[model samples]
Target: MKVLVTGAAGSIGRVVTPGLAERGHTVVGLDRVPQPDGEDGAWYTVDCTDPDAVAAVFDEESLDAVVHLAGHPDEASLPDSLSSHVVTTAALLDAVHEHGVTRFVYASSNHAVGRTPRTDLLTVATRPRPDTFYGVGKVAAEALLSLYADRYGLDAVACRIGSFLERPETLRQLATWLSHGDCVRMVEAALTAPAPGFTVLYGISANTRAWWDLEPGRALGFEPQDDAEAYADSVAPDAPEDVEVDCVGGPFTSTAYERPALDRSS
Candidate 1:
């Protein structure tokens, strides 16, 4: 299968490109920046927000599937930055429909369900209760995936991805950490799963204390091997004590809507 990965230069995409290539799939990496070392698969310079550019790439390459990973991942502080995210994702979905590409996997975030209280997280199904514009953009993308699946016959999966880091360093990471290997496996399952349509699954590993339920994803044959417990000792001491920080996915959802200002003293 030939897969087109948007935001190929991104942290997850950088690792994901190689992982897919190693699995015998051809990868076409699209990013705004050129690949510095070019060690990965074919890299194409692109801004996913541009409809013409995104469509041209799809028209040029007969993409078997699309792993949409490009977007503003953080929404807490940068409310003004999500216009690009919305435009890019909206364009990507449009291109997918135009090209008749059936398989689509969107990089939805745990932040998409950000407004849900921490206690209700375990049972509450995923809805568009976004806490920030970035999260709102993700929710929009998920809605597009659902609409496309239902109306246009496009098969899609939305992964409410937890942290793709190796370990949880901050308070929110305890509930959000998604190990590297686990992500690869989850993505692989999403790609190969049969009859997936508008499915939304959390991107957490098989941690002992997982906040979101993985039963629905289990039907997709997704069984995470890596566990966040490996980093328990290293990150446990840094855990937040109260609600302001504890287990609600941190400042990414809790922070005020203000861009990070430069420290003049620096």
Candidate 2:
């Protein structure tokens, strides 16, 4: 399969782009930044929000699928969030629809359900309860994907990724960490899953302390192998007890995340 990965220079992209190639997929990288050294496959420097630029790529490459990893990586004003997440997504989806691409795999975040209390395991069926504007953007993007799936028969998969890190660094991470290897595995599964129409999967490892359910991912042939439990003893001794672990969103649901919707000073 030929895959186009947006944000190919970002942290997750750096890992996923090469990892996909290793798994026998042809990877084409797209990002605003110049292609980094040692990146395997073709690379295009373009912001994903520009429909024309994005369309040109579709015109050039016979892409089988897209793993959308671009967008604002943190909380911001509502408008900025929408432009970064929703607008970028819309442009790609339009191109995907126009070019007959079969599948789209989005790097959605767990913040889409961050405000939900961590009383029970979170499933893809959980209602949207975004804890921040960043979360809201993810939810909106997911909705747009669903619309495309329903109307155009696009196979879209939204991966609500947890803490994607080298390893568990904090108490919250012990439950939420998505190992680099598992991250690649999750994306591969999303890209290759047979006819998964508008599916949602939590992007995390096989952690013993996981708060999110993995059955949905497993159903799609995503069998994550890493467990954060190995590093628990090293991280738990200094774990802080606070709002970070109180909900699926951790600190994103706390008062610290509250801010003016607009930054007029600029």
Candidate 3:
């Protein structure tokens, strides 16, 4: 399968781009920044929000799937969040539709359902309770993907990724950390899953204390291999217990997120 990975220069992209190639897929990278040195694969520098530029990439390469990871990585003003996440997603979805791409694997975040209390295990069927403007953008993007899938018969998979890190550093991370190896595995499964139409998956590892259910991902052949429990003794000892323990969104749902919804300064 030929895959196009947006945000190929970012942290997750850096791991996923080459990782996909190692799994027998042809990878074509697209990002706003230039491809880093020593990175192997065909790459294109373009902002995903620009429909024409994104279309040009599709025109040039016959892609089979898209792993969309380009977007604002943190909480921001509502308009900025929408433009970064929703607008970029719309452009790519349009291009995917214009061409004959069959699969769309979005890098949606857990923040989409962050406001949900950590009272029970989270499942894909859980109602969306976005914690911030950034979270709202993710929810909106997922809705758009659903619309395109139903109308166009596309196989769209929204991955609600947890804390993607090299290792667990906090008490929450022990339950939420998505290992680098497992990140690649999750994407591979989503890309290769047979006819998974409009699916929602939690991108996490096989942790012993996971907050989100992994059954949905397993149903799609995403068997996560890593466990964050190994680091529990080390991290849990020093980790601070805070508001994050109250909800699945962690600190994102706290008073700190209550700020201006727009940035007026130029």
Candidate 4:
């Protein structure tokens, strides 16, 4: 199948593009940044926020699927994040409808439910209680994906991606980390799921202590391999002695909106 991957130069896209190629799918990578030319697949300089540019690409390629990963991807960056999330999503969904694209795999965020208290019952059906403006935008995109799927018969799947980090070092990430291998599998499932309405799936690995649930995603045939629990011994044994909140999802929930920036590497 011919696949169009937006944000092809970004972190997940860099890994995911080659992964798709290895799976025997012809890939067309689109991004704002200039990447080295690829003979294995094509690359484009289209801006996903522009409806005309996005629509033109769709019209030119008889695309079988679209992995929509083009957007601002920062947690602390406020208005910019909101703008990037909302505009890019709107433009891409509109283009998908215009071009008769069959499947759309959108990159939503765990932050969409960031404000929800960490518990065993963190299902996909959980109502979005966003902790930041970025989270708000992700929730908004999820709604748009659902509406597009219902109205246009597009196969839209929203993956509420958790921390796609290498491994956990802090106490919070031990339960929220989504491994790279697991991310690839989840995206594959989103693209190839047989039955689709507006499915929302958590993008965490097979971690036993994860607060997010994966039963809703089981129907998509995604079975994660890596579990963050493997890093328990190497990571911090307890939450920071001075810190306040202490469930899996991290200080993100109880963090004062104006608190000093915690080092992302921590």
Candidate 5:
């Protein structure tokens, strides 16, 4: 597969690119910053929010799939995150559809449906309850992907990712960790699925502390390999009693909206 990966320098992209290349996919790594040295891909420095920037890449590379990970990763700045998450997603979807690209792997987040009770299973069928502006943008992207897929014959997958650190480090992560290995497998499944019209899957490891159901991811052939329980003893053992655990997004729901939300690292 000739894959165009957005945000290739981000933490998750750093984990995903090598594995995709190892699987023999020709990766076109796109990001605001340059893709790191030793990464096995053609790197392009481009802002994902710019349609021309995204379209220019499509014009140059005949792509088979797009793994979109470009976004400001927090609920801090509404305008900046919205620009990257919502506007960039729209641009990418249209560009791919226009260029006849077949598959799209959208990196959605658990925060999109963050207000859902953690006790209830969060299936793709569940209603979206965005906890913050950032989550709303992801939800918007999911809807945009769906519209394009249904109307324009693009195959798309929106993965509602959980905590995506090197490893689970906090009490909340025990139930929501998305290990790097599992992240790669999830994207591969999205790209290589035999028949993917439009799907939504949670992106997380096969952990015993998992709150969201994995049935949707299973149907997409995403076999997660890691379990957060392995690091349970090493991570923070207790959550602040005042911290709400009922919603899927945890503190994101309560975070005061602030400017500069879309920092470079996010």
Candidate 6:
């Protein structure tokens, strides 16, 4: 299958591109800027908010799947993040659906449901309680997944991904961290699963401290191999003292969530 991965040079994009290549997919990596050391897949410099740029790629590539990872990972000065996350996603979805792409794997976020209490188990059934504008963008993008699938017959999956760092960087991450390998496996499942209508999968590993439900992802064929428990003892970093530690979104739920984040690579 020929696959196009937007944000292919960003933190998560760098890893996902090569993984798809290893799986025998013809991968095309697109980014806002050329990566100094991009992967072996074909690379294209693209700005997701620019419909002309996105359309240029679609006109040239006969894509089978799209792993839409292009977006600002956190809240920004309103219009920029809005145009980048929401508008960019809309453009990509239009192109994918119009071109008859078979599979679309949207990189949604845990922040979409950040305010849900921790005592209640998090599942696909949980309603989105977006804690920030960034979270709102993710929720809006997810709505596109459902629309595209229902109206255009696309097999799409929106993954409300958790902390996708290289490792469990903080104590809060012990429960939210998604291992790099496990993330690749999840995308593999999305790309290969048979007739996956439209669904939501919480992107998390098999962690002992996991608060999100894994059954939905498992049913879609995502078998996570890594666990955050391995690093719990050394999980020295933590979220801000004022931030609530009980929710699924961690720091993102705080009003002080002004930090600029990278993509949800997991």
Query: Could you tell me which residue pairs clash in candidate 4?
Result: none
lDDT of 2 at 3: 96
Per-residue lDDT of candidate 3, residues 190-247 (tens digit): 9999999999999999999999999999999999999999888788554655775889
How much is 113 displaced in model 5, in angstroms?
Answer: 0.8
Estimate, for each residue in 1-266, the C-alpha lDDT of model 1 and write its tens digit: 89999888889887778888888889999989898584755778998878999999998899889998887666433334455556777788899889888898888887777666677546426446776667777777777787889998888988888778867675466657788777877878888899787798888888765788887677788898776766677775545655435435446554554456322445
What TM-score would each prediction reach against the true structure?
A: 0.89, 0.97, 0.98, 0.90, 0.93, 0.92
Task: List, residue by residue over 14-47, the lDDT tens digit for candidate 5.
Answer: 8788889888898889999976877655888999
RMSD to native for every prediction?
A: 3.8, 1.1, 1.2, 4.5, 3.4, 4.7
Error of 4 at 79 (Å): 4.6
Q: Write the per-residue lDDT of candidate 6 for residues 1-266, one digit (tens) a residue.
A: 89999988777887788888888889998889986462465778989898888888999999999999988877775566678778998889888877878799989999999988787568889888987778878888888788888998889999888989888867778888898899899988988888999989989899888888999899989999999999887765544353546676777777677554444447
Candidate 3 wrongly placed segments (more than 4 Å): none
Evaluated with lDDT, which candidate comes out highest?
3
Write down the lDDT of every candidate, Cα atoms only.
0.76, 0.94, 0.94, 0.80, 0.86, 0.84
What lDDT score goes with residue 160 in model 3?
98
lDDT of 2 by residue, 124-158 (tens): 88899999999999999999999999999999999
- Give candidate 3's error at residue 209 in angstroms: 0.2
The TM-score that candidate 4 achieves is 0.90
Please report the TM-score between candidate 3 and the true structure.
0.98
In the range 1-266, model 4's lDDT, one tens digit per residue, is: 78899998998898788888888888999998877556356788888878898898888888888998888776655556656787888888888888777799988888788777665658887788877767778988888888888898888999998888888766667677889888888888888889687899998888877778887677898889999999998976665432323433345555555433333446
Location of the lowest summed lDDT over 10 successive residues in candidate 3: 236-245
